[model samples]
Each structure stands twice: as structure tokens, then as C-alpha cells.
Target: MAAILVPSLLEVLVLICLVSTCVSSKPTNKIKSLNVIKELNRKGKYIGLITVTATEENAFFATGAFMPHSKHPFVDLAGRRFFVGKVNAAATTQQLLDHFDLKGIIHFGIAGNVNNSMSIGDVTIPKQFADTGLWDWLNPNATWDPSSYVAELDFDNYNEPNFNGSNNLLGHLGYETVQFFSESGDPNTPQPLLWAQVSEDWLQVAATNLEGIELEQCVNSSLCLPEKPKLVVGLSGSTANMFVDNAAYRDFLYKNFNVSSADMESSAVVMTSLSNGLPVIVIRGLSDLAGRQSGVNAYATFGSLAARNTAKAVVQFINNIYSFSSS
Candidate 1:
């Protein structure tokens, strides 16, 4: 089985909302969310700690006395206001970020990986993301092409001057994309999708502080990971809507891009933050090996464990955030 799990409720909500820009019809859940937004309007937060699933939510905020802000998820932690929601899709992630103003955005969730260096329970802080599987179908006959539709994504010219280069670990990066035939659409000339990067200052803080943090290796006595998990930083990854299960594709992505993780939503989150001129950081735990391992699909076996590691990493990240703020 592929590492891809069924579409999460958040993903489904995003897909449905996209059809009507989140106002197609009066759904019951929509009413509840609207009410929550009204309540949130009275009081929202500064930093948003985003999660994509119940598993991730429980891992981080379960212990806190968090109340739903107008029926949406928002909480106060350590003198900081935080919001946790199932922003599962890229569009949903952007929607949530825009819906609520934030000083910085942090994403903590589970991801797929085939990098042998990382284990199913390991957590990775990706410094940069390379988009894959997203393509612009450029017709050769068309003379006027949208500027967004280009031969390659330009990441070199983009720089973060405000990052305070003292801790920055980013530089000229050459991101890659693939060309292939889509089953639904006509065979078209493919173009590289969007490429964006996370803030180096945020990553450097995470790398320096959480570099050697201990990771979980077992969810329970009955089920355990094959190896101990570790905290990895400054790694790269590929993002795509489709779940990757093929070892060849995983190897190709890792070998080509030197990515340590794979995800469907991180790329979207990165682009959204970049668009808003915010420094977005991603903390993803490996839930599966992307078909590299022959045993049971690890997403089922180690999903919560991965979520725990991500939550732990986020706690550490948040501690660092406070330290930096105070300094």
C-alpha cells in the first residue's frame, strides 16, 4: 500500500470550499465555523501553531486548557495565543493564514519519507522545499504565456534580508520539477511548478536548539518502530498533491533534490507564508517510508508516534522562539 492515507476531513473541506470559495451552500459545519470566526473576531492570537489532523492536534494541545474560538480551534499557551486547526490542504493552509493574522506561522504534522537516514518516528525541520507533480500545461501554439507559467522556478533571486544572517543557512538553491503525462488532461508540455523556501533564521534556531533532541521509537509496547527516531534539521523535501508510494520515485526525489521528507501541504504553506511576507517554518515527523520498507504501512502503525515527535519538536521550537524574543 502507498504511504498516502485517505483524504483527511480538512482536505475534503478545502476541496469543497474551493468549489465555491468556501461559500457555496450553507452546510451545518460551515455554520459552526462561521460562528467560531465571529467569536475569534473578538479575540484572535499572534502565533498560529498549525496542525492538519486530530492525531497532530492531540499530540500538541491536548494537555492544554484550549477552548474553541467561536467553534474554531484556538488556545492560549505560555502567555502566547495559539490556534490549532486541521489546515490539511495547501489552499486550506493559505486560507487559514489569511483568515487569521499572525506574526509567524508554524506547522507541525506527519509526513512521508524514504531517506534511510531518518526513521518513521523521526522529526525533520525542512529548510527548503522543491515542488513536484505540479505542472503548468503550456501550449506551444500560445504566444502569450502567463508570467507564472515559466520554464523554471526562480529561487536564486529571492533572498531574506531580514533573516539576520548570523544564523542563516540558506543560499543559492536549484530546485527541480518533473515532466510527465497527466491521465486526465491532454498530453501537454510540462513546466516547473513554484519553488519557495522557509526562513533560514527560524531554521537555524530550530537546528541549533533541537539538533539532538530525543525522538520516540515506539507508540506502545505492542507496536514499535524499526529504529530509534532522531531530530534532523536543514533538510530538503519534495511536495506534491499525490501521495508517493513508489520506491523509485522516492529514491529519485531524494537523490535529485537531497530531500529528507515528503509532504502534500508543506509546499503550499511555504508559498502562502512567502506571499504574506511571513517566515513560515515546517516541523514534520515521518509517518511512513514512502514504500521503501516492505513491512506494514507505517502511517497506520506509527502515525501517532510521528505526530508526537512533531509536537515535541514544536514545543522545543516554541521554547526557542521565546528565548529569541526575550533576547
Candidate 2:
């Protein structure tokens, strides 16, 4: 009787294991832990510090306020901890989320300034981010079919001598915006969202506290900007995969989206943060005029200065983050 009971119990346990495995096969639509995650719940919440390039990361830590952890990839300053994610591209930004349990994210880097009013080394904190990469190229010689595409750019309109010029190379190029659906929203009835907004509460704190912070105006004695660099808050920024070096496209982005700055990764990072329900903000310093300059692009010359200025603002912003989080 005892032997029979033991076999029955073993069969029951095997059936339960199989059932659990089958049930877990369905997609959870969440980031699964890739490794045995060490629990940091006992330690204080840590914020994420993300940058696009090595130059940006070096400039950020140059502020001298942060102390690197002896063993981990974290930095400590003023009793606050931050996880440094200094990889390039948007996919890495998503990977960071998978690896660490971060309370919030702050992305800082250099960007091309579309706003002609803003000068090099000026830091901008945009209120929201948009992906300007989506587009459909139209046939240049095809008849004007209004139904061909939605929200077309019509490079013909910008065919001034300075833009498309007589060559009309961009006559077929059309620009479009991307539409994203939320994972948390109803699967049966989903809503498409266009813009990924930053944390309003965090933006308010920045607006109130960062206004008085001064920004760098010069790379050196000879390379100084004509005007002082100022911190401009509450503007919109555009993000895409390609580097923007065309004056015509830069003007189009400015006229269409009214974006203060443009970069390669900010939109993706912000969108990921928004999807995870984490507070996120972007700090981008203007390195060039986005081809608005008369000659070659200014990024090569002013990139470091712009990165340093962004770092300066980020350090101050982190110092104030504690108060906002506590409240």
C-alpha cells in the first residue's frame, strides 16, 4: 500500500510541473531577467544615467562630483547612487532596462540644434520627444496624387536656391511620423500615440530649479560663441537613426516639428522609459547648427564642449532629483 501511494504522488508532481511549463510558454510582453538578478531592494533606489557615446560619458564624470563603485558599474555622489549606461544606439538603451532595476532615467548627450536662435554649448531639456525617421519616398515624375501618402513634405515647397536648388535632388523625398501603441493598454482596443512626453512633475522641478544654472559659452579663448549659452527648457526634440547634415531637411524639421534639438537616440530611450512607467528626462547640448551653418558641420569642433555643458547641467539636475523623489 505504501509503495502504491509513492508512485501516485510522483505522477501528480510530474503533471503539475508540465502544466506550469505549458502555461508559462505564452508571451508575457515583459523583460525577463537574463541572469540570476541580485536583489537591490534593500539598498536605496538608484537612478539610471544613460549616454550615447564614450565622449559623453567621459564628460559627464568629469564633473568630479561622482565616485565610482569599486566593484559595480554604479557611481555615488551626495549619498545618491546611479547606474551608468554609456552604450551607443537605441537598442542598448532597451537592454539597460533589461539588466538593471532603475527608479528613473536621465539621458544626456550632444545634439544638433535646429533652432537657429540657440548657440553651441547651450543645453536643452525638451518637454517631449518624437521619432522623425519614418518616411515614404514618392516618384518624382509621377502625377501629383494627393492620396499617394499622408502628411507629405513636398520638397518642391522648399526648393529655394539655398535648399533643393535647381538640381531638385530631394523632390521625391517625403517625411512622416511614426505611430506607437502602448503595451499596457487594452489589447482588444488599442490607441496609437505619437509623442512620448517626459515626466511633468520632474520637468516642473527642473524648470523651477535649473533656470539659474549658467551654461558654458566657450570651448576656449578663440573658439568662444558670439552669444552666451543659455538653458532652454520646455522645448520639443526630434530623434532618428541617421545623422542630420542637410540644411534643407534641418529647416523642414524645424518648420514641421518645432524641435529645438535633434539626436540619434533620445526618442527611443524616452519611449522605453515611458513604456516602463519610469520618469525620464533628456539633456542635450547643441553641438552644431544641424547644417544651418555656412560651411562644414560644427559637430567635430564643438562636440566636446557641448557634451561638457550637458554634463554640467546633468550633475546639478541629479542633485535636485532627490528632493523631487522624496516628495
Candidate 3:
């Protein structure tokens, strides 16, 4: 007679996991730094996946998937892996990559325009991302100068000589950061420190293919923009949870950082990507003037047009990504 044998507890758990498609806890990182790539997968081959993340429904459509990530399984397109995941923010993106072997990350969406010269529906590829929400001095009595908000404020200009950087405020990143918000209510922060820099290779590739791509002037049958949309590249972007809709604030951001676009998510996403030594690119189309203009919010009227236009440029980039490491 054959000897009776029992399955190990690990083998039984694996069996149950197969029957139920549940997401297992992500594997831990060794260095515990933001730059460290999280565990790809405990099972199956690690496929070097190149993914484009978007934060909204309109932007998700740009990923070229016909169905949501829940209903449809991941499908490869353009000779590379193409899959759409739920919108990622700076807060959650660091945790979502455990399932794939990442090669590069691209994010696309609509933003409030900070540059007055640019109109609604124009797309911008931001050159850098800066966090504008931080305050150097916790004291309520400490006054904020209008020029103090500039990203390049010199270190000597800081009013508080004792103020250290915001390291304690944001902790546990694997790599060093070059970007600065402000130093102890002093406008004199370091100059030429980059908060987030887009990949130059990707930009060089995109600048050629993305040229002359037409933008949608009309959102739908019911609404239309006043002028034809255009495309602009290599501009700055700013981020804070606070909504920027006033002309004064728009002027402030544009003057301080040369910021062309302002949004809630891109800065966070860019920081997360760069911290991990991952290449990241941001494509933003303007749906509103970020309250720079008067009247009803154009986001309701022009958001679709902006999203579609931004996606068009992204699709163009994805279609020709033959040089990416994963590809």
C-alpha cells in the first residue's frame, strides 16, 4: 500500500489563493528606501512591464483599454505590455508596483493652467514638479513674503539661521532629494536644486513624434472652445492640495517656478517615481485657467477635450516606445 502523505501549510495556502484571486500583501523592501524597487511577484516570471498611470476616468481612456481594469484582463498592445490601473496619487503609487517589473512610468491628465499665454486645451510636458504647500516656519506670527515662495530662493535669504530643511517633515526616502520648498520662512533656499526632473531621453523621443499633433477644439456636440488648441513642451508644474483658481496665485506660481500647470497629483507622482530611480514623464492638458479667468469653471466645459488631447499625445508616445528598456 502507498504511504499516506499530508500537504504542507504553505502548499494548502497556495491552493486556496489560486481558487480566489485575492491580492496578497506586497513583499517587503530590503533597503526601505523610496528608490528601492518593490518585490515584483512571488510567483510567475517577472515580466518587465511598462505602464502608463492616469488619475481620472478621462485620462484612463488614454491607456487604450476598452474596459476597466476590473472587468478586462491585462492585454499587450503596441508590441509592449499595456495595462490600465486605477488612478495613482503621490500617496498610493509607491505601494501599487509590487505586481509588475517596472521599466518606466508615464502619467497623463488635465490641469489648471498657470501660464496665461496658454489657452484651455493646450497640452504641456512639465519640466519639473515642486511642492508649494510646505511652510518653513510653524509660528503663526511669522509672515510670508510674496517672493518667498520662489523655488530658487537662496539659502542666505532665510530669516531663521537655525532652520533645518524639511527632512523630519518627510522621512524615509532611500535617495537624497534636490528640491526645496523654503528654509525657515526664508526665501533664500538653494538655487538649481531640482524637485522632479522628467527623463530627457523620453522628451527627446517625444519632442520629435509629438510635434504637430492636432488638439481637439471642441469637447462634444453641445460645447466648443473659443480657439483651436495648441501644444507646448518643457514647462514647470506646481502642486498643493489647495485648488489654485485666482489670478494672483497663478501669477505667483508662474513667477516663482515658471510653472505652467498646477494640479493636486502630478508633483506627488513625480517625486515617488524619481525617488525610486524610475523614469517618469508628465503630460498635462489645460481644462481650466485654474481660476485665473473669470466665469464658470471651464473644467466642466473643456475637460473632455483636454483629456482627449493629452491622451492623443500619450498614445503617440506609447505607439513608438521601441527604445524603452522593457520594450
Whose TM-score is greatest here? 2
Tell me which of candidates 1 and 2 scores higher on TM-score.
2
Count of backbone collisions in candidate 2: 0
- Candidate 2 — which residues are off by over 4 angstroms? 1-44, 73-95, 141-150, 158-171, 188-190
TM-score of 1: 0.64
| Global lDDT scores for all candidate models | 0.60, 0.64, 0.53
Give stretches of model 1 more than 4 Å off: 1-45, 63-95, 136-194
Tens digits of lDDT, candidate 1, 113-134: 8688777888888888877756
lDDT ranking from best to worst?
2, 1, 3
As a whole number from 0 to 100, the lDDT of residue 16 in candidate 1 is 8
- What range of 10 consecutive residues in model 3 has the weakest lDDT sum? 1-10
How many residue pairs clash in all the candidates, one count each?
Answer: 2, 0, 9
lDDT of 3 by residue, 166-278 (tens): 32332111112345333332465544343667778777667777767887888677777888888887788887778787876677678866788988777776665665565
Deviation in Å, model 3, residue 62 alpha carbon = 6.9
* Cα lDDT tens digits for candidate 2, 1-327: 000000001010000011111223223312222221232222324455567665676676576644432343432222222342322111111124544455677777889999987888898999998788767777777766655443467767756667524545566655554555456765555444457799898788789889768887788888888777889889999998889988888988888788889998888878877777777888888999988889989998999999998888876776576556645
TM-score for all models, in order of appearance: 0.64, 0.75, 0.62
